[model samples]
Target: MSWSDRQSPIVAVATAPGRGAVGIVRVSGRGVAPLAQALTGRTLLPRVATYGPFLDADGQAIDHGLALYFPGPHSYTGEDVLELQGHGGPVVLQLLVARCLTAAAAPDAATGRPVLPGLRLAQPGEFTERAFLNDKIDLAQAEAIADLIDASTEAAARSATRSLGGAFSHEVNALRDGLIHLRMLVEATLDFPEEEIDFLEKANARGKLDGLQAALQGVMRQARQGALLREGLQVVLAGQPNAGKSSLLNALAGAELAIVTPIAGTTRDKVSETIQIEGVPLKVIDTAGLRADHETSDEVERIGMARSWEAIGQADAVLFLHDLSRMAEPAYAAADAEIAQRLGEALAGASTVIHVFNKADAVATEAVATHLAAPPAPAGQAVALSARTGEGLDSLRQRLLDMAGWQHQTEGLFMARQRHVQALGEAAEHLALAQAHAAQQDGALDLLAEELRLSHDALGRITGAFSADDLLGEIFSRFCIGK
Candidate 1:
């Protein structure tokens, strides 16, 4: 290992900033030895934690602690690094940091000028960036570090650890290399067409393309599931007036978030809550019940209904509470057939709906049981108990978790935003298109090659091989100042 020629001596409080038993000020750059020597007023050894007193301008003891020296290329950031451990008092650490900054600013004794390319405070994720620049870790692995830090659930943390161990990057690189091989074969076939070769007709080419597509599909499936587990589920509750929508919200949230009354249009707005089902985060939204007419202004009801449908459109899953008890009322029971006939077409387009038979405690009859069990939530749907008594809530929770694709062992996932998922999806689409084109006997091979190129570039963006400066800035800017 050799020092990164582009490295600068960066310093920061590697440990959390606050009062504790100890605080460490880390410095990394070309001149770590001299910097430590100036600060501690003693010779330092590599990989050894030596106890010493960090000094002030006048040789006064600022703090007595430990000093560790790590020679370049074998340490974090692949640069010469030094760590000064001292008492965790805020003022003491501040002074120590100031002293190190001043010392690192001085010229190297051999050069008699600034040999350290200016010891600046490390930027948020700068150390990790350096690691990536030096080939110590890839961009995906570096991002995993932040995910591990910001993980909201145990499952998320587990997945982040897997990513940090290179699970996600390994899978991506494998796919990328496979794509390269496929492209090589296709390009070779195209270049040597004079040999009367039928590349498309060749079993080798067909088998390779099929296998590549299958592998890509498998990766896409896992990526989608991993992304869902990382991001969690967003569920929206929508139904008609007095459908016990607010009650269901409260039941799911385990608290009264929205006002529930006998009033048909009591909730003329939207309310949202976050609840965990089997440790999977579910963002539940309760909207104003949809109705034909309202005493409230039509404008208000219109906006509420619009928002309800908006939620339904964006939701990963929906819980349509039908209020079976109310539906079974004598006035309602007579028109059930007619209403079902009309509602059939509307429900068909819903992405994923869990036909929750709310208020089950009130309608615990044989007919209701048979009707509820008859459909099985239509393959990813569920029917459960009272939003009031919390009955069958466990089953509902499990169903929601299952829909989110949350697994008991949530390993090998990294926290990714909607943007990353979109890019990967687009790449997968292009790859699919390329496969489709390649399967043809006498088709536009150039178009297929172009799609493969586009797909490769899309994957390149994940590791930042094809990212812009603004994107990097935007990503690191979101981190805490001392990260």
Candidate 2:
């Protein structure tokens, strides 16, 4: 949006678009008091909820509601804000919004001009974006507002709340402060080339760099976990028909989410469930069995297999299940080998593949151990379990948590996005370069200073201290309207 568009007074239905106990129409911009007075037919006490009838252009009561006014530089958008809370029916809310527009456009008796010129409807996330722009909150906290709304688990919600409360931004600012101090020391020493190294040593620049790197690593680790919580892993199950793929999904989810049967090719489409392990959400997908295309003359089975491969290719992890009971059959073994080769080609090391040996109850203990000893696909982790008995499921859950890099600690953790993680990664890379420079016997003070600056800039991106307009637009655009 242009500067003028942002400057215009904006209004939106603040509550969700549905029937509820109450609904709200929120307006924010400079000089909104007149609009408030015009809407309510009376001057509203600042920050006070005064029950009154919202008036129309003809001075008729559109709806009876509570009118609240907040003066500029203190409200959510750092502008004068007016809120009208009424009944939650969608029709009434829209009527109130329409009244607001009409009232804003109507001419005033004093100057015979629109009461609130340039009043418009708010775009998605414009309110929160204004909060960020006004310094009421940082970019990270603004993102946390959406994260909190979209959080799927209790842990995720708590983490998002922490982030919205500025826990993550505080840590990032602390790191940036340290980097600034170290950069000051290094840049100041660059003026005296002869004593640059001695000055850095005396100022403990090397020790400070080490400390920043350590702190960055700690933050990086937590950010990874937070990102995992935000964007959970996609795990796809693949194997030959009747290899217990559906049964395994049911077992992991602890519910019969997928229909399991002795018949082959029962699941012609993907059946997915999101299960949480140690607060980390894992979307487990059960796909149709992989078989020779010629073996299935049915077009639906062929299409299902194609989609299964598609899911596998896009998955964060693929569970290549093996039926221990069928491993002894020559045809089954050959088919498993072919599927493994295709899986290897399909994934191309882009995703991890876990070898799951199912139906252990139907196989001998020695046989299960032998297969587990050397899985068909030796690259990823292997597990032997019985889906029907729910045996060894804990081990699989732990494996997933390990793959997610979850340390099982949620306290004080702040929700983070992939961009935040990438920014931290970039900062860490620069910090590593700074360390390499400092380790040199005759370190290049200029190069070291440049690295420190780059790292600081990277950290600044997280809090929006150094952010592009496009990035800001992209981040806030995902938020719901009126946020």
Q: Highest lDDT: which candidate?
A: 2
State residue 136's C-alpha deviation in candidate 2, in Å: 0.5
Residue pairs of candidate 1 with colliding backbone atoms: 9-29, 107-113
Q: Which 10-residue window of candidate 1 scores lowest in summed lDDT? A: 334-343
Q: Pick by TM-score: which candidate is best?
A: 2
Over 1-483, each residue of candidate 2 has an lDDT whose tens digit, in order, gives 788898899999998878998999999998898899898878888989999898887888888989999998989999999999998899999999999998899888798999999899999999999999889999999999999999989999999999999999999999999998988888878876775358556988788989999999999988988999899899999999999999999998888899888898899998999998877889999999999877889999999999999999999988889999999999999999999998889889898888999999998999988888875746448988999998888988888777767888999889999999999999999999999998888777789999999999999999999999999889988888878
Model 2 local distance difference test score? 0.90
Q: Which stretches of candidate 1 lie above 4 Å from their native place?
A: 1-7, 17-21, 107-111, 191-203, 237-274, 285-293, 296-315, 320-355, 366-382, 405-420
Per-residue lDDT tens digits for candidate 1, residues 89-173, read 8888888888877776666778787535567787777777677776787777777787778766776777778777878777777
Q: What TM-score would every model get versus the actual structure?
A: 0.78, 0.96
Question: For each predicted model, how many residue pairs clash, with residues at least 3 apart or on different chains?
Answer: 2, 0
Provide the RMSD of all predictions against the true structure, rounded to 1 decimal. 5.1, 1.7
